[model samples]
Target: MTTLAGKTVVVTGVSKGIGAAVAAAMVAAGARVIGHYGRDRAGAETAVAGAADGQATLISADFHDMAAVDAFWDDCRAAAGGRIDTLVNNAGIMRQTGGIPDPIEDWDAVWSETMTVNVHAPARLLRHAVRDWLDAGKGGSIIGIGSWAATRGTSNPRAIAYAASKAAITAATKTVARNYADRGILAYVIAPGVVRTQMSVDSAEAVGGEAAVTAGLPMGEWVPPEDIGALCAFLAEGRARHLTGSTIDLNGAAYIR
Candidate 1:
């Protein structure tokens, strides 16, 4: 219902999972999408092929690398054919390892990669893309994909670094919103609970059966990627202008705040 016709949206991590679903949803809404992938060119090309006419373009960049991150913005700018109207910071890393006798290298890798993709890269991209738009007195929307771990303490011991990284994202969202609100650039965070992605399924299996884990949810099921995609679509539209600086939870009653 929220039409994004003529608008250009850049979604990172679009090779698969929620990123791919969000890109598809945006294309369905009539928005021209720039699907950003690190090394999954084949997957990104296939995704674009499945989209509507002139709906999606595949862009490649490694968020963990600063040089690649800069070049990515340039590529996105060029692909958008002008300014980027919507920026979806969806690329993130989740490692399930750590706690007592935790390996220092594992912690470093998780923390570093998480901060780079989930925090630093998004922050930098926003600074580059939104600054001129804001300066020129044009408004835009920025959505950061956060995790429910940012709120509740995870029982899964291996998720400490990931959780911490997401919390930082939520904080960055608020800061960006405050700093850019007057310029009409809004920022928001979508923190989803355990979704039925392959990663979640694997984690669930490691602890127990997927059904058993999902039964704990008040909704009695894991949140689907499409559901999150819908919310992201809404936030990317100008209709949610008043909802800036907020972190909306999509946990389906699991870890309700």
Candidate 2:
């Protein structure tokens, strides 16, 4: 049997990148996935179409808006037959700003948006999910998509807000795991290093050469988004409950801690 057979999963930011990959992987593993998107409705639909026949449902929500997040969950719960077994909070934005001097407006925009999507929305979603689990007397898994920047401070000042937001997510994951352990819910964070996403490629080009930046990695290659998705799938399947409350690093020896 598939590892996630009959499971119901909710994955945010499913329009593209890591979120899309995780949603697709879960559906392939026999889970019924609710693929959440913000504006990329076409991309979300493509992801669902690529899934194993009838394996996924698509929902749209502007995660930055609390009301939209609530409605997203409502639709997800209904699609999942009233039970959400796994949640993958993977929506995020990365603004690359060199250490060069910048106006306060730039800093404010990045910080505000990053915190809203990376920290606030996920926390609120977790709170609601925990309540639902308690009400239903069932357990579930929550996987937060974090970044290596959480541990390794960004060299660029423009990325400060992004790093801080992800760091907050890491701490939040631990808190949720600790408080909900006895209640039967598991929370874990996955911090990916330099993944070879479109964004990464663009950043590499903008910063000079991709090889020059990736040469620092022990693996000498950019990590794939699917790698993170696979790890998340394992966590959501409860295969390693003992590993709950942990931060699994996927940075290819970039940040060993």
Q: Candidate 1's residue-wise lDDT over 158-193, tens digit each?
A: 777778888987897789899889888899999888
- Per-residue error for 187 in candidate 1, Å, reads 0.9
Clashes of each: 0, 0
Q: Write the per-residue lDDT of candidate 2 for residues 57-169, one digit (tens) a residue.
A: 88888878988888888888889889999889898877775223767777777788888888989888888888899899889988999988898876445577888999998
Among these predictions, the greatest lDDT belongs to 2
Runs off by more than 4 Å, candidate 2: 97-100, 205-207
By summed lDDT, the worst window of 10 consecutive residues in model 2 runs over 95-104
Superposition TM-score, candidate 2 onto the true structure: 0.94
**Candidate 2's C-alpha lDDT?**
0.83
After superposition on all CA atoms, how large is the RMSD of candidate 1?
1.7
lDDT of each: 0.81, 0.83
